[model samples]
Target: MTGKIRVVVAKPGLDGHDRGAKVIARALRDAGMEVIYTGLHQTAEQIVETAIQEDADVVGLSVLSGAHMTLVPKVARLLREQGVEDVLVLAGGTIPEEDHEELKREGVLAVFTPGATTTDIVAFIKSSVAGAAA
Candidate 1:
């Protein structure tokens, strides 16, 4: 909590769309959190590496290509494997309500659907990792 919160906004797999990811990244940065936006087409390893290297307090994965089940959890598992079990993992964009619980079980703390407000997302990150920033 002594330093600003850091978040890694990643677009994994072949998801060419990046507008949503960028929007969230800017929102987090605007909220006074350090955000690292991993551009389009990043693999799970790349995302986890960025999160580790950035010392991210949160990892936000935005997928519109129906690959949330594959991509999101992989990044989470890899992070945990690298001894990063504390990073708050979140998924958004085209993820169904049905998948939310399963994603949570798989290490994702939350999943934001299409209509989720930016304010809610920022608040969630802040509240979820109340004293994690360093």
Candidate 2:
């Protein structure tokens, strides 16, 4: 494992909006993690490929198009299919509270809602990677 966390922050499907994703990407990069923001309307395949190619430590999916159930898990599943197990998957943006557990079961490590702070996100990634190392 490297000292810096590599994060692939993706906006998947036809979401058509990217402000939140861009904000999070900026925050993650500013926090000293290597960030690859795969701009708007990326497919599950593209996202997974970026993660695999970048050897990303974390994948932050930003979805607001009500396709969370499908797109988010599809990325996770694709990663696993490609033999990616160490990456910590996380999601944010308009995800319903009720859907969190099912997302987690599908391989997402955590879900952040509208009010979740960047500090919390940075801390979570740091601790999660550190804990996984231990």
Candidate 3:
């Protein structure tokens, strides 16, 4: 809580679409959070390891491969298995409204679907982290 909110922006599974991830990473950085982007095609294991190594407060995942149901929860489970209970997991890209509640139940703090603004995302991260610290 004393330092910048560190975030790991990752793309897991076979998804090659990275524009969204990059945009979010840049926005977070611009908003003063230290963001570590794990490039394209990362694995759940790699993401968790990165989060641990980076001492991240948040793990922001971007998936356009329609594997959100599979990959998102896998990352969440991996984080939990690694004893990362305090880290907030957020997802973006093509996720359906029907799956939102289920994803939250899986430990994802929030899901940003298509058309979610970068400004809103930044505000959410700031307010969410600050509120958690409170």
Candidate 4:
């Protein structure tokens, strides 16, 4: 990769809880990637816009509001609709196992659930973004 992986960490929908999102953002940053956190209550449009503006290599979405079924796919669809072909989309926080495969089909590269280590997340971004960088 030419530089550090650029990641957009976002919280979509009415998810009031953000501890997980903040933790991931800090981990990514500490791992040397550029992390742009969109804060709380962001819409799919806002997240996609930030990703495009930031030219993110990956978009790490954290949703704890049980709306991942709706919001996650929306963000993924928006990215594709906007022609963002290179950014790898990832999701985390309270995702059910049943929804994992569907999220992948909808364009989310991976879904990290509860108890996922920050080191693993860092490693995944590094490897995934490197492959995409090619």
Report the number of the highest-TM-score candidate.
4
lDDT of 3 by residue, 1-27 (tens): 698999999999999999999999999
Q: Which of the two, 1 or 4, has more TM-score?
A: 4
* Highest lDDT against the true fold, candidate: 3
* Colliding pairs, model 2: none
lDDT of 1 by residue, 9-28 (tens): 99999988788888889999
For residues 62-106, could you state the per-residue lDDT of candidate 4 as single tens digits?
999899999999999999999998889999999999999999999
Ten residues in a row with the worst lDDT in model 3?
A: 125-134
Model 2 CA RMSD to the hidden true structure, in angstroms: 0.9
CA lDDT for candidate 2: 0.93
Model 4 stretches astray by more than 4 angstroms = none
Q: Residue-wise lDDT of candidate 2 within 1-134, one digit each (tens)?
A: 56788999999999987888888889989999999999999999999999999989899999999899999999999999999999999999899999999999999999999999999999999899889877
Q: What is the clash tally of candidate 1? A: 0
| lDDT winner between candidates 2 and 3 | 3
Residue 67 of model 2 has an lDDT of 95
Q: Once model 3 is optimally superposed onto the true structure by TM-score, how far is the C-alpha of residue 115 displaced, in angstroms?
A: 0.8
Model 3 misplacement above 4 A? none
Backbone clashes for every candidate come to 0, 0, 0, 0
What's the lDDT of the predicted structure labeled candidate 1?
Answer: 0.90
